[model samples]
Target: MEAWKEKFVSWFATSGRMNRAAFVKRFFGVNLVCMAAVLVIGSRVIEETGSVFASNLVSGVLAALAAVFLYSPMVRRLHDIGRDARLAQAYLCFGIPQGFLLGKVAALPPGSLGLYAFEAALAAVTLLFIVLVFHAGEPRRNAYGAVPGRAAAAQQTGRKKGRRLKKAGTV
Candidate 1:
């Protein structure tokens, strides 16, 4: 648990490198947790207020916060791959507009063009996110920082050896 907290803190830090393994692990794990929270809280909000809008309001705020947690890691991951972090701007370009438009289109009747447009924009943003998450990081360190996997492995191995030596009454 303490290690997870430390990892989460680093995930939000801007000055670091994140390899593909780190990115994928954080992305999937964090997203699954966020999704579950949204489902539970959004449903409860809707049930309490009898308003889908109320639920959306609560969930949208939560989602936005989750996106912040996601964004820093993505930027670092791109940095690890020798790509500029600014590439994330493309996601914002599509995502921001889609976010606002989605709420408006939610009340639209079925088969509405506005809804279709929203879907299209959402699809594009999702695709970009998928590509970034799956893209391989540089095999060696680039300008950004050291490779995360190697550093983490070394750290873990050292900790394990220390624990063994401690148990043997050797510091």
Candidate 2:
């Protein structure tokens, strides 16, 4: 438990480097926080004034902007863990269709077990994909640049060398 806590702290403190578990945990935590905020504030606003559309629109826009801004850092963190940014694109590939299917199911006849089965399968597959992303192999140096932890160490060494040179008036 201590080790796990240390890993979380390290991942959060480091600029981009994070292990897969840490990355997944952080991603899920962010999503949960966003969902909670939307649920609480949106529910209050709607209950007080009965404007479901407005509340939904506001929450949707907020979530979209958060996703857009958070994506790059998330990608960078994935790179640090040795995964490709394309892995993050799984949501576009699988999640969108699943969401559409869900909507279709909701609109179907009341006694449709078929849609429920399909939805369950889709949910399982989505969960599997999330696990796969977290379990994917790490790269040595991905397109995001060198591995962050190593790069930081190298930078520190360079700075130390520069300082020594300066002290010797040979820089």
Candidate 3:
């Protein structure tokens, strides 16, 4: 239980590299949960309130919370992919409108200029995110932190051994 708490904290509270496999697993897992929540809880709120403002409000709040929760991991994943971490900001830029427009997207006219722009931006960011999930992370230590997984353990063990040797003046 303690170990799991530490792992969760490391992923959510810090900006550090996250390899492709871990990123895909975590990202998709969170998305699935959030989507389910939105569908269930948001719908419940709408059903109770029977108002557009209430539904939109719930969606917007959930979207913002999801974005905030995902920010660190998303940035870390981008770092692992050798991309600028700030790319995560694009998620924030699109998230609100995506939430607010969730129901209205279907009604948007095909030729609406704003709709095209929003769709294009959303598509581009989504494509980039997919590529990040599939692309292998850097194999060695990077600016963000040590390599993850087994390679990281090996690197860290070697470093610890070196440090011990240096401390004993046996290098």
Highest lDDT among the candidates is held by which one? 3
Name the candidate, 2 or 3, with the larger TM-score value.
3
Q: lDDT tens string, model 2, 1-171?
A: 999999656543424555556456666776787778788888888998899666766576556644543455455565665566675554444433442354356568866887677767668646744664555435576655676467789899999999999999997
Task: Note the Cα lDDT for every prediction shown.
Answer: 0.75, 0.61, 0.77
Off by over 4 Å in 1: 1-8, 93-101, 108-117, 152-171
How much does candidate 1 score in TM-score?
0.72
lDDT of 3: 0.77
- Give the Å error, residue 120, model 3: 0.6
Error of 3 at 156 (Å): 7.2
TM-score of 2: 0.56
lDDT of 3 by residue, 62-151 (tens): 777777777777888888867776678787777655777766765788888877887888798788778887788888778877777766
Ranking by lDDT: 3, 1, 2
Candidate 2: segments with Cα more than 4 A from true spot: 1-26, 51-59, 77-85, 93-125, 136-139, 168-171
Residue 12 accuracy (lDDT) in model 1: 74
lDDT of 2 at 76: 58
Taking the tens digit of each residue's C-alpha lDDT, what string does model 1 give over 12-41?
787778777777887888778778888999
Estimate the TM-score of every prediction.
Answer: 0.72, 0.56, 0.78
List candidate 3 segments past 4 Å from native. 1-8, 155-171
